[model samples]
Target: MTKTNNIEKAYDFGASEFNRKMKRITQERLKRGLPVSLDIPNDATPEELEELKAFDAWTRDGQPVED
Candidate 1:
């Protein structure tokens, strides 16, 4: 497979795994009657998009911790 194809696959897997974990955590927090929060922007600037892309790359590399 091409490099681009491999990158896409890695990003997809990372995103899916992230979503699954987030959903589980949210559910558990709700069951406990605790507040859970997410900071998803409705509109993103070019810099923000670039930063997000970098974060995805980090996640793809198996380093999902946010700084």
Candidate 2:
């Protein structure tokens, strides 16, 4: 449907823009000797990706983590 297509397009555009900003921020941080927030490698495995997702879910978007 047209609505689904538009939503997918919006998601793709947002994801692309986010990646662009992250890459720019990462580059600037590297130039300034600052630590980057994300550090997943190009060859990351499924387990690594899942771990990252779980970690993000627990720590991001106002999600509370138990001590």
Candidate 3:
């Protein structure tokens, strides 16, 4: 007896979620700037820590790490 199942309703919900995500991404892009490239140390992670142990960068010395 229920008639709540409808394609239009499903599409409306999906579109609403998509719009919300789009807005959030746009805001972050503006804050961080677009086309950003990250150059991290080879030992950035636990796995990479060993590989990059010998490698050193003058810029990273005593500087806080940013992911």
Candidate 4:
């Protein structure tokens, strides 16, 4: 029997890809400074896109901290 299943491989691939894309976005945003526009990819899943938008909004809001 194989050690890794297709589903596991697919999930890992998706997660790694998401992280890689996020890293690229982070670098670009850092260069351009905060309050950056939504830079999500066209092929991003709906959930990913939503998360990106929410994160962008949070950053634009100055990422408030709870005291």
lDDT of each: 0.51, 0.46, 0.36, 0.48
Q: Which clashing pairs does model 2 show?
A: none
Per-residue accuracy of model 2 over 1-67 as CA lDDT, tens digit each: 0123345211221144554455455556666888657567889997666555544333233322222
- Global local distance difference test of model 2: 0.46
Off by over 4 Å in 4: 1-35, 63-67
- Candidate 4 per-residue lDDT, tens place, 3-63, comes to 1344221122224555545545555676687544556787999667656655554334333
RMSD values, in order shown: 9.5, 12.3, 19.9, 11.2
Give the clashing residue pairs of candidate 1, or none.
none
In angstroms, give how far residue 2 of model 4 lies from its true place. Answer: 39
lDDT score, candidate 2, position 46: 74
Residue by residue across 1-67, what tens digits does model 3's lDDT show? 1113452211221144553444454445546766422246744885344323322221123332222
Model 3 scores worst on lDDT over the 10 consecutive residues at 7-16
**Clash count for each candidate, listed in order shown:** 0, 0, 0, 0
Quote each prediction's TM-score: 0.39, 0.37, 0.29, 0.38
Q: Write the per-residue lDDT of candidate 1 for residues 1-67, one digit (tens) a residue.
A: 1134345322333355676565556556666888866564769886565555554444334333332
TM-score-wise, the better of 3 and 4 is: 4
